[model samples]
Target: MVNINEIARLAGVSRTTVSRALNQSGYVSEKARKKITKVIEETGYVPSEQAKSLRLQRTKVIGVVLPKISTETLGRIVEGIDEILSASGYQILLANSSLNKEKEIAQLKLLESRRVDGIILAATNREETLMQTIRELRVPLIAVGQDLPEVSSVIYDDFNAAKTIMKKMISKGYRRIGFIGVEETDQAVGQFRKQAYLDVMNEENIEIQEGWMQQADFNIQSGEASMEAMLQVCSTRPEAVFAVTDRLAVGAMQTIRKRGLRVPEEIGIAGIGASEISRYVTPPLTTIDYQYEEAGRESARLLLEQLESGKKSVKKSVMNYGLLERDSLI
Candidate 1:
């Protein structure tokens, strides 16, 4: 364990000068900084994170809480966040909430206990508990994907994206279009996308079949199960289905294929969240490009602004959505 004193002695400088040079303090001359850095490299000296944090009153660590880490959209968002945070000399602590409210709250508490400088959350719909916990955190907190009334957030315009997709479907002669999503309380999945679907369907005078509307957790298995159940209602088969996410759409497409149905010919499938996998699927799904990476980058930028400004004002950022047309729907 090489200490600052040893580095100072070896570099033929005082401990105070070494500390200033190592910390990159303004008082240290360029020549001294270069000398100290060279000596540090040769000695294989590692600075004490505890001492550094104690002096700065910050850990230089940012916590990112995500609903699920395995999903493609979330993964891309993390990549974007890492790209910015790493360049700014900050490290990220990833915590997976597993879409569980309790787990998310617990993770936030743990991060606070670790004295993280800030936190970024890709929250679930049922995040009241997490939101309340965030209010008490000494460090700054930013929400991503879902907005909190009193907190800063970066999100896509899910409502407009859904409405646009539904409108496109209706214009393409999809008279009986079904909606597949999660619970209504889920702001992104259930409320925004589902409401847009219903509003557009009603406005177009399209009759929604009772069994065609379904909600479930965002998972491929849930999507498959929901679509399977929808297929059982023989009286009314939807001409097209709009899933809230690419995973659900992929699952629905698999069900359609299994039943000897062809996409766009027998049953069209479309969804939100244009993940990379969406483009590689058998039919190359048609989906709304939610720009999750852009959301992540914007969230990072917002948090950095808060950190630099040392202000607690809430900010809201909305990203644009694009539609990707493919073989899943004509």
Candidate 2:
């Protein structure tokens, strides 16, 4: 694909001159326009939709900012979003934050600079600075996985799902269930989910131990570390360990086996996000199916609707989930 820079070099002009001539904006001399036109005509150089949108003011590109690109959940969500956007004559411009919260704010500005028609943010943490940034953006946008009154969001039923799964573990005779969770800044995955676990334990009259609650980042290595930490601090080990995500649960399983504990016997383990790899893992993981793909499709639809209707009304769409009672949490 030939870019605008190549066209500028061929036309013997600066990039700004080429942009002005192609977009018919700013000031381009007649001689420069003619030269640019000649080069474009000879090379059949077609401007990108983004470049054209800058002039005509309609780009069919949707910017998607994700926490990271390496997870199965992220992959599935992007696939779902792309399916809908591509069918509607639109494309995705992806920006990965690589798990850095600050980068999410930067990606929003970067996407706006590219003149995208709209944006869909798969956010992790909803910091005040990020919310302020979203308010200032001059385009239609929707969020997924985190709810904010100021922004339209498509999120999972984190609290209910956590409570339901904890009840299930208790029903199966697991008295003390340890929790492996992320930081509390992420409202959906970190705060609400952990709060649900604690609430359920309180309701069931189960003893809560400080050592049984461990914090982990969103990764397999962190899960392993958290599980190890929980075991080290707890004089009496919990019968079950519930992690917030499948990646973390898998890591906990690794640590459990290293300690010669048998799953569902000495210790049971579970996680949310019925990720693709969850079914293949040894003693297939028991988890909650958060319907991430559906969330992506819905977020795309909502953003497109807002773009077409020019409606800025804040809409919140909460998604449902299902429990997969697999071998890991029998």
lDDT winner: 2
What are the per-model C-alpha RMSD values against the true structure? 6.7, 5.0
Q: How close is every model to the real structure, measured as TM-score?
A: 0.85, 0.86
- In model 2, what is the error at residue 91, expressed in angstroms? 0.8
lDDT of 1: 0.83
Give RMSD (Å) of candidate 2 vs. truth: 5.0
What's the distance in Å from true for residue 130, model 1?
Answer: 2.2
- Using TM-score as the measure, the top candidate is 2
> Model 2, stretches more than 4 Å misplaced?
1-18, 21-56
The sequence of per-residue lDDT tens digits that candidate 1 reaches over residues 115-140 is 67899999776456666788888889
lDDT of candidate 2 over 56-151, digit per residue (tens) = 355678999999888889888898899889988899999999888788899999999877889999988888889899999999889999997589
